[model samples]
Structure formats: C-alpha cells, structure tokens
Target chain A: MDLYSKEVMKHFRKPQNVGKIKNADGIGKVGNLRCGDIMYLYIKVAKDKKGKEIINDIKFETYGCTVAIANTSLLTTMVKGKTIEEAMKIKKDDLVKKFGGVPFIKIHCSLLAVDALAEAIYDYFKKIGRPISKELEERHEAAEKIGEELKKHHGGLFKVEEELHKEYEK
Target chain B: MQKRIYPHTTTRTENQRYFNRERRFLFGVGVYLDYAATTPVDPRVLKRMMPYFSKKFGNTMSLHSFGQEAKADLEESREEVANFIGAKLEEIIFTGSATESNNLALKGIALARRSSSGGGRHIVISQIEHPCIMESAKWLESQGFEITRMAVDKFGRINPEDINKAIKKETILVSIIHASNEIGTIQPIVEIGKICKEKGVYFHTDSSQSLGKIPIDVNLMNIDLLTASSHKMYGPKGAGLLYIRKGTKIEPILHGGGQESGLRSSTVNVAAILGFAEACRISKKEIKKEAERLQKLRDKLIRGILTRVPNSHLNGHPKMRLPNNANFWFEFIEGESIIIQLDLLGVAGSTGSACSSIKLEPSHVLLAIGLKHEQAHGSLRLSLGKWTTEKEINYVLKVLPGIIKNLRKISPFKA
Candidate 1:
C-alpha cells in the first residue's frame, strides 16, 4: 500500500555520487527563487583511450526532497557515459517514471532535477565552444511550437480590441 | 558500472503503488483517518435535533405556545449539558463555539475581577493553552494585567509545581487546556485546579479537545469554568457550552435582552443545542469503549510508523496522550510533501494543528514541546475517531513507510 517502491527508497537512502566534482568539464547550476528547489551538477566528460566520449565522473549537490535527490542522483547515473546530446534529451516524465511515479503535485520536484541535468549538459557544450546539440535544438523547437499554439489561439483578439477602443474614443 | 536503465522497472511499480494508493486513499475510498477535527454527526443526535428545526421551531423568548415548547427543549438541553459536566443547570451558557466560550471564560472573568474587586490583575496560563486562551491573556496584558505563561515538558505537559510557583496573590485566574489539539497531551487540570482553589483563584480549562472523548467531572475537579464545542463531539458546529460554576460572577461580554441569566444574551440555537445534548449523552454512554478501540488503533499506527520508517519519533506523551491521538516526525522529509504523497495514496491526516496549517511557521504546540524548527516542520498528526477501523489503520501502516522512504530520497535535507 505504500506509495514508493523499495528501489526508489534504496537509491534515496544511499544516493550515489552526492557531492561536487572538482576540475569538472561541465558545471551546471539551475534554480529560481520562486520555485523553492535547486540543484548544482558537476560532470567530468572526456574521451577514454578508446576515443569514446565516456563520462569519467559525475556528482551533484541538490536542495530538494527525497524525490528530487533520487531523481537527480538517477539522472547523473543515467547521463554519465552518454554523449552530451543523449543527456540533454532527458525529460521530466522519464525522471518521474524512474522513481516509480511521483505524486502529481510533486512532479514539479522531479522536473526541477531534470532541468538541472539539461543545464549541466548545456554548460558543458558552452565550455567546449560547440553549437547547441540536436537535443537542445529539439527542446527549443518544442518550446516554440507551444508558443506558436498560444499565439494562434489568442493573436487575433488584440487587434479587434484596439480597433474597437479607437472607435469608442472617436 | 552497468548503465542505470532509463525506466527502472521495480521503481516504476513502487511509484505506481504509492501514487495509486495515495489517490485511492484521498477520494473517501481510502480510510477516513482524520477524526479529531470533527466527527460525523451521530444519527441519534440528528434525530434529536430534527424536531427543533421544523414543527417545534420557535423563539425561546416568545410567550406563544410554539415558543414555550421550543423554550422547554432549550432549557432541557442546558440541563443535560450541565449534568454532563456535573455543574448546576443555571451555570451553563451557550455560545457559537468553544473558542467563544474560552473568550467568555477568560475575558469575562478577568474584566469582572478587575472592575469589581479591583484586585487580582494577574493571570497564569499554560504555554500549551489554545490560542483562544493564550491570545486573551496577551490582550489582558496589553490592558495592564500581568500574565505568566508556565512552561511544559517535552511531552507538552505542564507540571503542577510549575503552575503552583507561577501563581501569586495577584493571579486572578488560571486557564489551561484539558487536552491539546496538536499532540493530544492531557494536562492534570485537577491538580492545577486544586492549586488555584487553595490560592483562592478561579481555574478555567478549555476542554474543547477533551469533552465527549473523556470523562470531565467539573465539581470533582474543582473547575470553576470549562469550555467545549459541539462539533468536536459529533454535534453541529454552531453550538458550544461554557460551564461557569454557580456564584462565580463574571461580566457579560455580549449585552442584549437578558438571556442565559444575563451571562450571554443571544437568540438560542435550539436545534444545535439539542444536538449537542444528544451527542453528550451518547458520548457519555460510549466514550469508554470508544476510547479503548481508538487507543488500540492509535498504538498500532504509532508502532507501525516507528518500526517501518527510519528516524521517525512520536511527538506527545506516551500514556497521558489522548487515546485517539498519534503524532510523528520523520526527519529530512517535509510534512506537507509527505501529506501530499499520502493524499495521493488516499490517507487523510494533517501536518500539524489544522488551525495553524495555513501558516508556514511550525506549530506553536510543537515548538512548546521543544522540537527544533526542522523537527517540527517534519511532523504529522493522525487522530483516530469514532469511525476509525483496524483495516484503515493497517492500510495506513502498509502505505506510509513507502511514501516516507520515497519522499526521503528526494529530500534535500536527507542525511
């Protein structure tokens, strides 16, 4: 009957790599004061002798709840050896699903963790002077699509209101 | 290291169970766990109240036949309430709530003494007294009356000696809550009353959390004044009783056409009063068995949480606490976060005092019991009541540990 799975609790109780990484290739910090949850992720990404983009190390310092902590910890593990593009595509729903399912009200906490992970990957990309990854581009396109939908829904009313107001003034 | 899978299968099922259970629990499909806030109106009480709202509906003060019948019902309710508390019938005064009754008992007594005897301008109250009494004491202080707030132990219980030492010749009244709404710690009002009586000072207790849940013998306890609400005891919300011992004069707070022997002057709420009386009668007959049943459930809840949840501790007195009360604090987890998760799981409980839940500040009662800010913030109160069942308690036990564990994982404060 308990809401959380034993595995979620296990990871939560003993989080892997829970501190900061020094001399990291990518350092990402994400937060907004109004949101009340924040995370700082430090990742070491480099090519191994095999010339593969292997994650040498990952650590995070997060200010959030068990879900947030577990989500961030799981995120670090999930993205450790993946190419930067793969890491950037990680979604909030993915993080929540990994935790078995967060309460709907607290799905935001998981989102905060996912957002931090993306920021860290972006920071890594910036440090290397690379253009935005395909994942980042996809994220931007998704946001634009949402904005376009909103505009299409509401763009016409403003012009009509302005014309009507001018006629009333006249 | 093996790549941690993007979709952890076991974790998904756990989260599913947690969220699904929480959802099922909240929509009344889950156990109705919150009983102390207010109980479902007993069917008998509803039956008793029905006549007053319909054919028998009349103003008690009116001289007509219909009015006389209504007046008779009101007087009978007054007598029933008085008898329940072992007080004289004339001493009982009706109010809108226990909060109002508390205000009348403290303010009326203080103002009356200040105006009449021109002495005894000091009042002593326990640190854990309901805000109704505590705030009234503060108001009295602003009016030049000295107030002494005695401290309680970590169990949220005041010692008799502390109360005795706090008392002085200038102390006009000593007001304490018979049972705390948060931790459910029952104070030794009898001992406090004895000390006040010995010192020739009036003693009042806010029994809002105790009446109908426990036996209260005002005469045996030497209680000069007592306050309780009908809603707390399975009656309607808009009715309450203030028992002022006969010959203990207090100035009326509300002045109008003389009613309640000029102590309180308001049109009677006939149906509610009748309901209140009926509730009292039912509680008087069933409280002992009800208390035992609730205690078993409360004990199960406490033991289950402590055993299953790491770093969880009980919040109130072990034995002296209310039979229906169980409060716990799980470290590193936010109480609201856990409550939300529990809500998803379908359990209905509270983080702290229902009255203080809106404010972000930790409960004052929790603070009084010596909980640090962080510990207080992690608190949850589970109060059992008439409808609480063994199955519900077991379900809560099964569900809560996983919620706490899942929440602990995401908590920034987790050690």
Candidate 2:
C-alpha cells in the first residue's frame, strides 16, 4: 500500500515551479552533497499600496525524491498569494501535514523544501533594504535559545554553537 | 481542497500504449530501498579504476614493463579482496562472475575429489541454494556423482542439524549460499561451517549478495570456500572472486598459461578487479552508515505499503531480513505489472531477481518458504541501495498503492 495520497503523486509528477526566474527578487539555494538532496528557490515579491508584501511569482528546482518534489510544489502553491511574513512562518511539519503526512524517512525532504522557502524570504528582505522583521528576529532568538539549552544539557554538544551564539548576540 | 490526482488516469491506452510511454521516468530523490540486487558503484572505486583502462592499459600476462605494472595492480587487487574476506592472498581466484565461481567451487572440488580420492563423490547443497550452486550440483549428478539437497524452514533458512544429518562419508563438498538472494535471509554459515569442519568435508558458500552488505569473516565463519561477485557490491560486472581457503584442493576449471595460481586461466581484468577492490574498500568504510540509513528507509517503505494496501503481506522475515531488503506479495496483483507500472512512474527496481525475471515462473525462493504459487507469482522486491534517498521512498509510497489498485482492478485473481 502507498503512504502518499494521489494528490501528492500528481504534484510530484508535474511539479509547479521547475525553473529559475532571471533577476528574481529573492533567490535561495540550499542543500549539500552530504545530504544527497538539493533545492533552489526563486521568488518575485511585490508590495501593495498599503505596504503589504505579496509574492508575485515563485519557482523552484529541486533535485530530490518524490516527497521533496511534492513538498516544493506544495510550498510554491502555499506561498504564492501569502505575504512575506506568512511564508517565513511556514514550517516543515506544516508542509508535511499538507500532504496528509509524509512518510517518516521523507520528512527530512519536506524540511529541506521549507528551509529553502525561509531562505528565499530572508533573501527578499535583504534585497529590499528593509531591516529584518522583529517577528523573524524573535523566532531566530527563540531557536538560538533552544539550541543553547540543548548545548548546556549535552555539555560539549558542539563548539560551533558558541560561535553561532556570539554572531547572534552581535 | 483539490481532489487527489490518482495515478490510475495515466494508464496507457490499448492501442497507443507502446508508442507514447515515457522512456526515462525518474522516481525523484527518495530513499533508495533496493540495495540487495546491486549498488551504485562508489566514485572512489571508479577513480582507482580509470587509469588501468586508458593510461595503464596492458595485458597482465605480457612480459613487457607495462604488463608487469598491470600485473602488479592485479595482484594488489587480489590481496585487497583477500584481506576483505579474511582469506590469504594466494587463496583468491578471480572469476567472470559469482555463478562462475560457484560452478568452479562445486565442479572443481568434485572433479578433484573424484580424481584424488575416487571414493568421496557425493555432494550436499541446501534446497535454497542459488541457481548456480543448484545447477552445478545437478550437473555433478548427471556426471554420476550422488547429490543431496537439504531442506529449509518457512523463512528459507536451513538448519545446521539438517546439514549434519545429510552429510555422509561419501560427501565430497557441501555448498550453501551465505544469504538467500530473494528473501534476504542470512544463513547460519558458522554453524554449517563447523558441521563441515567436524565431518572433514569441504564447505563452500556463495557469498555473492552478502559480501559487501554484511560482515564477512571467513576465518570466524569457518568457510573453507566462498564466492563473491563484484557487480553485487557496486563494482563493475564480469569481475568476481572465489575464496578457496588454503589447503582446500580443487582442480582447475580453466587450464591455460597457469593464471590465478593455476586454478582459473585468463588474462586478468585489471580495471574491473581494481574497481572491485575499491568497492570492497569503500563498503568496509561506509557499511555502518549505509546499513543504518537503508534500514530506516526500508522500515518506512514497508510500513507505508503495509498500512496503505489491505490484505498485502510481507514475504520474508520481518526483522531478520537484510536492512536494504523489502519483498511484499500483493493479494491480487501480479509482480510484473506492478514493476512495469512503477517503471512508468520513473521508479527503477526488480520484481524478483533481475536474472530470473524473464522465466515467468513463480520465484522458487518464495515457494520454498511455503508461499502458494499465486502469492509467489505476485511478489515484488524493493532492495534499497546507497544512492536511495528519502524523496524516492516517499514517491514510491505515494505512487505504488495507486498502481496496485489499478492492477488489482484488472487482475483475474481474487484477494
């Protein structure tokens, strides 16, 4: 029996955004050879008269399995009309839940796609010369706090964490 | 919410099916689950092999300087394979394939015994022996040597007691596969080896599928003779090894120019041997990581298939099977149809053994494990590999059930 719904296969087979946008407002490329999965996301954002951010177009090219493709496709559809803040808040677990829950092993693939989305949003803000949002900064701080707690619990979790914490504090 | 896009609508029409099929369908980057059949050749192994094919290309048998260099590389490869399998460098004999290795081990040993002792002419092999060992035993019977076939249990594993009971004073050699290729059931080789040792009989194991996937300590297992194919371990095809433990006498199968220590005669396939050695080395380094990842993917795929497909049953041992192996029998669908459908969706895998896919017969391995002919005929094997990713597994998880449902609709068999 298959674990994914028919909708997931359809999205995977014919992924929505499969090419790059030249001069894309926000471009995010993530993944590494060690992970055996890679993804590049491109987004063009436009702000309305009221200064509400809107994603005008989105595209992605992912070299990953079906879940990666499906999740990327789902991410494109999920963020096309949303504001920048909404897209930034999209989580890996939420994307997986959108597909009726991806298989356990492939949950990482969904996470990769979501990471690409977040990176793309961050790139958009950097390109627009706007300060990083207070909300995003708070989220980053919370994540660092959790990471610090984990390090303290583990004692010598990773020396690299100390460096990252110093950067965040600055 | 939009309605799900079922895979059923993508079926080829009766008239236009052959013309419009997608040629290179990909399953995306999902967890690869099919490692038992074959593995992607490691890049490091390929890197080590590139020089021999182009710059260092020379016949190992030639007496020229280039030939001597080639010959040195060949011998080094032999040593690496020997060290990997826990055998002496001189004990390793390169063969064209594990099938060839098994034939040589059985026929070579049998011929040697007939010529030397003239009395120990009987041979014993497990009922679950790979076709190579089984067919060789049959050929030995045709040559007037008696052959004994040992029985296996429901999980396709032979009991050591059965081997002990089957042995006789006339038993010249006992050949068994280290692991069952189809079911991924690893045999108790140590116990069988001990039995053969106590009886003073030669024990040979066809380790073609198990060498790179599992830990193989020939000295610890007491295996007197073992066979391995490079292709099964992510190396090039047409290269294999036969580990003949020192002092196990075997007549030469190919006699010419005294190559492979006068056992098998042929100019060494230096490039393939080097590649095989590299594959073995890389496997030794990464086996722990690969096995763990493959096991996780195998479990997820198995769970997804079992939970989604009603009345589907797993064919092999639940936990005792290989980490990269998962074989399932769908109640009403044929294995071939599912494989073809999966191929159409861009997923590449085998139904049973790729070698036996053309035979149209139910897998003998499945039958030996008490599966009815129908269940045996409908078995699908998805062996994971190192290149497999979580993306591939999820794609399979999503696409396979729809394919099965469509096939079941048209199948004549009842669940």
lDDT scores in order:
0.76, 0.74
| Candidate 2 local lDDT, A69-127, one digit each (tens) | 67788899999978877887788888877788765666766777777776677777777
Native-to-model Cα distance after best TM-score fit, residue B25 in candidate 1, in Å: 16
DockQ values, each candidate: 0.06, 0.01
User: Candidate 2, which segments miss by more than 4 Å at Cα?
Assistant: A1-170, B1-34, B353-357
Name the docking class for model 2.
incorrect
| Tens-digit lDDT track of model 1 for B316-340 | 8999989999999877556765665
Cα RMSD for candidate 2?
Answer: 23.1
Q: What would the TM-score be for candidate 2 when compared with the true structure? A: 0.65
Error of 2 at B285 (Å): 1.0
**After superposition, candidate 1 runs with Cα above 4 Å error:** A1-170, B1-28, B353-356
Q: Give the number of the best model, judged by lDDT.
A: 1
